[model samples]
Target: MDRRTALKHSALIALLGIIDVKKLFAASGNNSEIRGFHKFNLGKLELRVITDGHILMKPVQPNFAPGISSTVVEKTLDANFASKSEVDLSINILVVQSASRTILIDTGCGANFGKDSGWLTENLVHAGIKPSEVTDVVISHAHPDHIGGLTDKDGQVTFPNARVYLSRIEHDFWMSNSPDFSKSKITDEGLKKMVVAVARKNITALKPQLHLFEDRAEILDCIRIKLAPGHTPGHCVVQVFSGQESLYHVADLVHSQVLVFEHPEWGFEGDTDFELAVKSRRKILNELALSRALVFSYHLPWPGLGHVKKQGEGFEWIQQPTVLPD
Candidate 1:
């Protein structure tokens, strides 16, 4: 079946991180949408997982796990009991409410991608938050899926009331007259150009509200941006703290909870610096496993709240159970 046909035929709730979908399970009404948004609490802060939906990449060999063949990827998938053909990349956006601030870690794909992937805005409302109520937007990087929702087609900022924060390195990399992709494995020049166009547009629109922070800078009282690089020169992860509790928002550190966790050296073709990404992944994964801190993944399964653990050769993602507040 074709990609759309396959997706339409499949029930992807199980397809966890830019993940794995086994079989087709048709849906009715708001059920699928209801599945798109999840809520819970982290210490004194309230958090929400609002997905912009997902991206389906078929015959994942070339587009993902860049250095390996589809045959190799299939073997790994087969061993893990996941689908051996494609992936439904989850686009999980995090919303944080702390005392005086309502923050969004990464804006969803918006309409830049398509209908199936721009669910962030409405899902935000259903989750009882409004775009205008978002006081801050902490961008992990400038990928289309992460920043596309920042502005409308008319190039106007969507979250009018929010001040946007991005790592200074990330800001400069994309804003530079010539953003380099020499190290990227992405062979499609069109897609690369689109990346440039989309990034510059939304970033330029965010200029007035944009605040550039240095690596390891704590933009908020409880949230700090840490440099992770590799996927993009400026790509970074976020750390959220509450009292003694903390959660790491590891954005695109690895796209798949399976492929990446199983093999930190593998990466999607779009990685700006695949080798660098691998090094960063190994370094950060080590730290996370050692820290045993709670984590939130931008592309992991719903809610994307989990913990990291050392397994055989690599680490594993241990998802936390959702708990409702009294």
Candidate 2:
């Protein structure tokens, strides 16, 4: 090789040694990214949207947002100013401090799926609340992402002192001998079985601490379970009341902030019953729009606190601005 080429290669290698590219990438992945947790107060209640982690669903075609053409999906994403190639689904867990009870709405994806997720325990610690400090864990459904975090990889209970709560119907659906997913859009039997196995494993592990409540049961005199089945047999939303202020925690009602809001009738591939999911989405979105109450969405952007506004034929999510602490 020529002397000039050798000199250039040597300088490049020297720069690489000084730069520490691995450390730069590591910092980009961990330290440089914004922290996940958000805390605020609602009336007499202290509320927080803790981060669990996130998943990016790719293809954005028939699987991610079913019952629509790829062209339509592309147009919708363009209109919403989101990436036209992928769908971003964030796992935002709701934490409510009611009286002496520390209530957690849903645990995040624990040791499941990808490495980017399963950060619930770590993030919760960063939020100044230990898993043991959680007095109550209210589960919205039996989905893996919602209940998988209840236990660690070794099948150890994460919240040792917390009493787990879930709908009786939801518990039975997964615990039943034969789970019927005939109405589901997902046609892969093996994939469905894996999902069922995860739910059953997590639910069974927490059975001792699990407290099954009837639909619409008001537990702790502050949290009300609103029956919004469709995503699952026993899927529901939560209504948290404090003094005169209220926070309606709509768990997994809308996966996409813009697409779901723009077309409530559309089907999500994850929904067990697409038709029922659409109905529930429309019902809750309409009620929220009319009441103008605060809504907490689990799958929207981080700290998914917002209000629903009725648009022409559908609804729109109006994200609530973060208020600074005094």
Candidate 3:
């Protein structure tokens, strides 16, 4: 080989080795725990997060402003210490394991969305659950983050032995042949492909194992599905109850922790019905604060277990730290 080319290759290898070393050391320290998982027991109910990771999306101006002033929107974002008009949304999947059933609230981004997600399966296994052992897969909505993990990398069912549950309205909206599909706010073709793939595998078309429930249907003994739409046509949140203790899984009810909680009126472009979404957010936030029920949010930071506290006209979210099992 030519001397110059050989030396260049050696230098490249050395540089790569250095990068790897840095990453290894960082990972061994705090980096590996980036997407954390935590578990809590409310009497007999055990609720946990199988973290799927997070993403930074370019903030669309429509959802941020709508009727509000740009100054107000930008000021709110700035007040929250965010920049670049970028919002970081953390994704966490809820795992509810009890004496009666093993339920997963949302599937999370499947294997193909990129590196930021598709970790739910691994975390599930780590949490001492086999994919087949998941008895019920309850979807909060049909959004990608909530339903992506329905199929695995090979386009196979991730929870092969589980009964899939979803809101009938959510199922109908995505499967509708209406031209309104062209007007969807998010214009990503990948998203459309995902919707179509989901249509092909629509729970209705699957085994009788798939059941469609209307709003406010009780899925099992202590779990009730409540419709909290406006984010989508059929978005529903799952609430788990055991005696007096309860955990509310508010899926995508709020995306950006700051944008949703601090500026409750600000637009969230991800929602199909932006105006309606804001209304739903306000209502849900009010209920959450008043009810004092512990909430498990799908897009909140890892181990997204926390409560909403009333702050003036709006509210603030404070995530509870890990509660070590006794």
Which rank order by TM-score, best down to worst? 1, 2, 3
Model 2 lDDT tens row, 73-161: 88888988888878777788998986799999999889887776788887777667898899999999989889989989899999999
Model 2: lDDT of residue 65: 69
Instruction: Write candidate 3's Cα lDDT for 1-326 as tens digits.
Output: 76444434443443333322112111223333222356668778887776676665765365444556777778777887766377656777778888878998888878756887777787777667889899998888887777878887667788888898888898878777651443235566676677656644645444467788998898678788888877788888788888888888888888767767887777565677766777888998899999988988877765678899988877899887753322
Model 3 misplaced regions, further than 4 Å: 1-36, 59-70, 179-184, 187-196, 199-208, 323-326
**Tens digits of per-residue lDDT for model 1, 1-326:** 85444444343434433333211222344433333356677789988777778887776777778768767888888888877777767888888898899999999887788767877777777667888899999999999999999987677788999999988888888889998888889888899999998989999998999999998898778898889989998899899988888889999997777888987877778889888988999999989999888889988766688888888888888988863221
Model 3 clash tally, residue pairs: 1
User: How accurate locally is residue 260 in candidate 1, as Cα lDDT from 0 to 100?
Assistant: 87
Q: Give residue 37's error in model 2 in angstroms.
A: 2.2
